[model samples]
Target: MSIMRRFSFNHATAKFWDQREAVEACARTGSGIGLWREPVQEMGLEASAKLVKDAGVQVTSLCRAGFFTDPTQAAIDDNRKAIDEAAELGAPTLVLVSGGIPEGGTIDSAREGVKEALSVLAPYAGERGVTLSIEPLHPMFASDRCVVTTINEALDLAAPFPAGQVGVVVDTYHIWWDPQVWQGIARAGREGRIASFQFADWVTPLPAGVLTGRGQLGDGCVDFKRYLAEVDATGFTGPIEVELFNDALWARPGAEVFEETRAAFARVLE
Candidate 1:
């Protein structure tokens, strides 16, 4: 049997493609995918599930499930549904973005919210055999996008959960600039908590919204090979998913972006 290469595409980049088309694109490239809930929901979960099954492509993860820093019971309940969707689609993990500070809230309060949210959802994720991967967005988004802004912060959040239930997503884009990153990666590996490793190049003067400005692999400051080597040393073998949220990439034809992304991913890792 041929060894599968280490690469996965984030469905968000294929914003133009309908659900089935996105799955087919991954299938044609013999690649895996990271799916987002909005598109999956719009396309119907069952329909998306069937398409991935038929196409024989792996759903590496479900893009998100956590955005309730002032987490109410309702937010916890919603994450359960996200877990169910991931299970139905055979996604091994659910990517979680610890939500931003609530109104009249401090960052400390938001951290408490993350703990509360995870406390409610982690057990449920474990029951379903789905790993919850907490992704720490860049500090630039600490106020509005995600509270967990460093791998250390994510690890701290995941530490309480058993390895099977919760782990940290070490996305290079968010953490490449962190001075304490090396220790964080090593500690995550030591604890067996390296859940879903991702890739995105780092560009300067981050774009507004701080969400859509992710650079294509090799187009920015990230040392891709260094990250690969570090993660590889951890003995955690998983797809290094390319998850660029760039508007320019999103505007291009899916096929064109896919081909370019695949090439960039390979080139950077090489």
Candidate 2:
């Protein structure tokens, strides 16, 4: 028998392509997809949802939620809307990139804000049958993108929630360099917290904004087969998503990018 697995292409990987076309391509390739919020909103959530559904494409996750570092009511409200959006689209996971340091405070305070925000949002996500996947961005993004910068940190933050309610996203680009990555993966599996598993190889001399330097699947140093094995050992059977943020990819036609990414992802897995 074959080692059955599912692959998902995140919308960010198709930033160069039109959103609908991206989803269509993933569907045609018999893979799943992860949606981004802005494009979904711009295309109209209901319409986008219908498009994916009609294409017979599974939505592994919705790109984001939980930027509530300030822990303000507005932040909470926005997250709630995000949860609703995820639920509306039948996405099982809502990837959360915890907001960075606030203007007036320190990283510790921002973390505390994350705790408060999650405390408020977790129950709602749980009730709606959506998993909130807390993503630990790379340390390079520590100050502005996400304060949660390691799998361990993400797991610690998720420790308080129910297993199926809140979880951590394991994105190779962000956590690959960590010394305790294996331990973190083990812990997350033991706790049933690996909600989304994403791939984006690393590239040195990271770009200025540090957002567009993602390497293609097999072109970078990531040992994808090993990563997949670790995830498999955890008994987490969710789709493995490719989420590259490279500018070159965005300059190509969505179909070409999607095909190339899918091929690379499959090649590395083999």
What Cα-based lDDT does every candidate model obtain? 0.88, 0.89
lDDT per residue for candidate 2 within 20-126, as digits (tens), equals: 88888777777889999999999998998899989999999998887788888988998999999999999999999999999997999999999999998999999
Q: Each model's TM-score, in the order given?
A: 0.96, 0.97
- Candidate 1, TM-score vs. the true structure? 0.96
Instruction: Name every residue pair that clashes in candidate 2.
Output: none
lDDT of 1 by residue, 1-270 (tens): 222366888887656666677778889889999999999898899988998999999999998889989888888888999999999999999999888889999999999999988888899999999999999888878999798999888998988989999999999989998999988999999999998999989887777746888888888899988898899898988887888888888778888888888888877765
The superposed Cα distance between candidate 1 and the true structure at residue 234, in angstroms, equals 0.3
Q: Which runs of model 2 end up more than 4 angstroms from their true locations?
A: 1-5
Top TM-score model: 2
